[model samples]
Target: MNTAPHSLRPLGCLKAGLRQARQQRALLCRQMATTTSSTISSSSQTAPDHGFYKITDPKTQRLRSAFAVYSPSAIATSPSALAPLIQPSTSSNPSGALARLIVSPASPDPLPALHQVQIKRMDPTGARTALFAKTRHAARVGDVLMVTHRRGGEPFAGVCISIRRAGIDTAILLRNHMGKVGVEMWYKIYNKNVAGIEIVKRRAKRARRARLTYMRQAKHDMGSVSDIVFAWKKTRKVMTTRGGGGGGQRLVVVLRRRRRRGSRSREMREGVGERRGRGEGGVDGNRLCSCYLFC
Candidate 1:
């Protein structure tokens, strides 16, 4: 027996032994280099094929996916990493780095935000009064509206009262067809019986005051008989009181009121020959007169 170490015990044996030891060391080094830890780590985590989660690195520049999931712990470490890419996540957001690392981002979504709504059929003829009810019969402030009233088969026109937003439906003020501007009226969705409940295309926002515009235009275009007497009264009040004007404005107002009212009071009594159901006209008529007087 030779007194050599086991590796060098024999020429063939020693060579084989040394080669085996060398190979084992190389294998151990390779294994160490590939491992995330001292032990083998699983590759079944959320991440892109490139191995990064949340696409923080984004392998390349364009948006990676619709959304990236992240780990809260790992995410906190690189809190500002996503700032340039998208809107800042809220403090309550759970998206983070590790979460991204664990799961692949989702595909980008293409969704529309708002859609147009349509009114299929509304008693178009009665739209004026209906619109008035909706607008609370406010003044025709900004622009004028155009309407088409069908007297027999021919269409006519006029201006409108104010238009306001009432819940989802738009409310508008319309001068009564009876030539009483003080008789502004309204029509709810359910009550469109004038001609037919057919809503024409929505108005192009020519003026911010769609209601008033429509009222003004409708009288001309639709040829609806207008009751702008109340409107005139209201305008005269503002011009007389708010700004510097001649006493003539007051005289004009009083004289105009006396002439119109004196003649109108008799007309009103004759026109409203019978009082409508208490709640239906009493309260509303009062409101109409008040709007004519003040607002």
Candidate 2:
């Protein structure tokens, strides 16, 4: 009985220890849960509301919430008071609608406005119209074109093989032969680096296809066009000399001669000839005179 009591005492102590351990584990789990809940609540309270309007801070150069400038309470209390602050939309005032949409309580879609701005910036000069329009003189496939660079290099002359027209992203492919090797280049038409584009030679006959890729073969190739380009440039120079202010130099020489004659007549009227004369009628008898020839 004494041994039985001793063994029973050990089992009871083990049960008590297990119960205390379980209680400690439960207390630890409860503390962790409480801490996590507190952290989550604090984070929720401090989180920034991205739905609100944002204004740029001039001093910090950062975007901040506009709650201070436009409070919800003020908007709710006197909606009518802010009506005058909003620009009135009218048919005569195109920008009024944009202004109202920006300052309104709701967020406005920016896609339409951005698209208009992009379209306006794409082709401000209407050069694309003159180049790609469906007219008789517009640049087309198989036409020789010269592209000059704004930074100054030898102008590239080539046969236009293909044209890709995608609004601001329009481009053209040109092919030429250099040192018996074929060379090709792609040029963006509206790029700022491109100085000018001129049609050098039109095709003898209209190309049956849009892209002249078949010209890459030996049988269909047009070969080196350097001679044609040189002749065209020479002819252009001759035409410019004949028509563009070529007579202005001659007219200037004639004007200079007339001014000289007028100055001589003025000097004669001032009695300069009489002062130097050796005989009557303001004449030097021994000197040969050219006044009669001038008269």
Candidate 3:
């Protein structure tokens, strides 16, 4: 009973369709507006957050910025922006440079030294005498020294002693113009130019020194018992053998072995030329003699 006419139904359907189309169009318009707003927001710049970047006042008008993000690969960046990122070996570095590595080299110290040394020994005879050093400044063994003596308290000349050793004080000496070393033959001038005992002791005390051997030799004269004896035996031997003309020739050989000192007693002072008795045998300034035994 209430059903519409067939023609009216078609007209209602059309109205309903029109209303749905209007609602769809309105919804589409709202969607387009939202999309446009989103697009604009995405394209524009936003305010920086404290986590992303830092701001700095370089100086007057100069301002700078840097990124705080820590990523291994992110370090390959611009110089000004990346400078603050570098770290130093110590915590004190505010600028953050690599820091210098300083070091030093090594060295050595120093020492002291010496002057001269003697190789051989020389006769102590001339040593005390200033003449000793003067004669042989740098004396070596085998050197010769003139021998002298006193005859009847008179100065006699002789040439004896050849150097054997070279030392600071004592040295080995041979007598008789190149004789072999023997007791009297190898006599040592403990102090050449040797002075009397009293004088030596006095000088030593005056100088407040240990020894006056040097002082004595310097002032006193030198003579040896060996020189006298050697000459003594030589002269006598000449008298007995060559008689008078024997002076020009060297003395006869001395059988330095110990023999009888006198014809009567078996006394002795028989040195090198034991062949004859003590009269003239050694190299002392005065020398031993065979005269008493022979005559």
Candidate 4:
């Protein structure tokens, strides 16, 4: 009975040792898992610095810090990797590095940016804005306007009937009379072919509507404005001359000679010998006569 108890004591000691070994192994595995998870979380929270950093050597115990130089092949192959390293542009000039990058030769699509630049160049003075503004001085419907074409043609003077406010494509409709016939035309305000626009006359009274399409009818029609245009031109003929006495300026009457409409025989007779001599008609027969009036 003594020998049997001693043999069972050895078996119990072996079972306790096995349980302790299993518990130690589980604790070691849990510690390793926690260490790995902490490393992963720290790496994810911190952002990598693309700038210079110090590198410490384990063997020599030396520290080195310098700018990192990348090869052209690496830059070409992995542009996204190096994108964060490039700094944003700070210059205000249009010919700066960023501007050159956007307008680079490598770009296949640059028409949209180029078109916006062209639109800005087309209206540099903001004259189109003033002409279509809602202010008291701005042009309105029923106001007489004269538009001159760069390409040779008679200037068109008409009343503004409608205005379309489309960006880069703004246009105005004008109606006028020619030889007892009503004529209407559309003029693009920012067109390259339009030389200039002049306000010939303002409306005596404001119109009741935005568009004056009712003026097209015979009953509401405004007759030919040619007489008013001629009167305006006559008023613009007064000239100013500076005096040498006190540096004061005086108004002068500029008399313009009118060509006589007569028979061919009469024109031939007047051109024969009368034009060669500077008689009472002045130095050049067609020269303007200035009559100075002291102010």
Best by TM-score, which number?
2
Candidate 3 structure quality by residue, lDDT tens digits, 1-295: 5565875898989877876675555444323332133332332113212323445444632223362222222222544333333332253342222231111112122111111122122232333323234232322222223233212242221222333332334433432222332222343333333221110000111123222223224243233334544555455553474234552243332222223334623343233235433323432522222121100
- List per-prediction Cα lDDT, in the order shown: 0.37, 0.60, 0.31, 0.58
Tens-digit per-residue lDDT, 1-295, candidate 4:
6799998998999888876675565444333332133443342223212234656546744443353222222333455433422432355343343353454344235565665566678867766656666876677788887778888699888889988876667788888899999999899877878777766777877888888999899998887878866765553332122233532222111111112334454554454325323323543532222221111
Flag regions of model 4 displaced more than 4 Å: 1-119, 239-295
Error of 1 at 283 (Å): 44
- For model 1, residues 51-122, the per-residue Cα lDDT tens digits are 233333555442243333222333334435343223332322334423443354443332211111122233
Q: Which residue segments of model 1 deviate by more than 4 Å?
A: 1-158, 165-167, 177-181, 188-295
By TM-score, the better pick of 1 and 4 is: 4
Q: Rank the candidates by TM-score, best first.
A: 2, 4, 1, 3
List RMSD in Å for every model shown. 20.9, 22.7, 41.1, 24.0
User: What's the TM-score of every candidate structure?
Assistant: 0.20, 0.47, 0.16, 0.44
Query: On TM-score, who's better, 2 or 3?
Result: 2
Give per-residue lDDT, candidate 4, residue 223. 73
Clashes of 3: 33
**Per-residue lDDT of 199 in model 3:** 8
Lowest-scoring 10 consecutive residues by lDDT in candidate 3?
196-205
Q: Which ten residues in a row have the lowest lDDT in candidate 4?
A: 249-258
Task: Return whichever of 2 and 4 wins on lDDT.
Answer: 2
The model with the greater lDDT, 1 or 2, is 2
Model 1: residue 183 alpha-carbon error in angstroms: 1.5
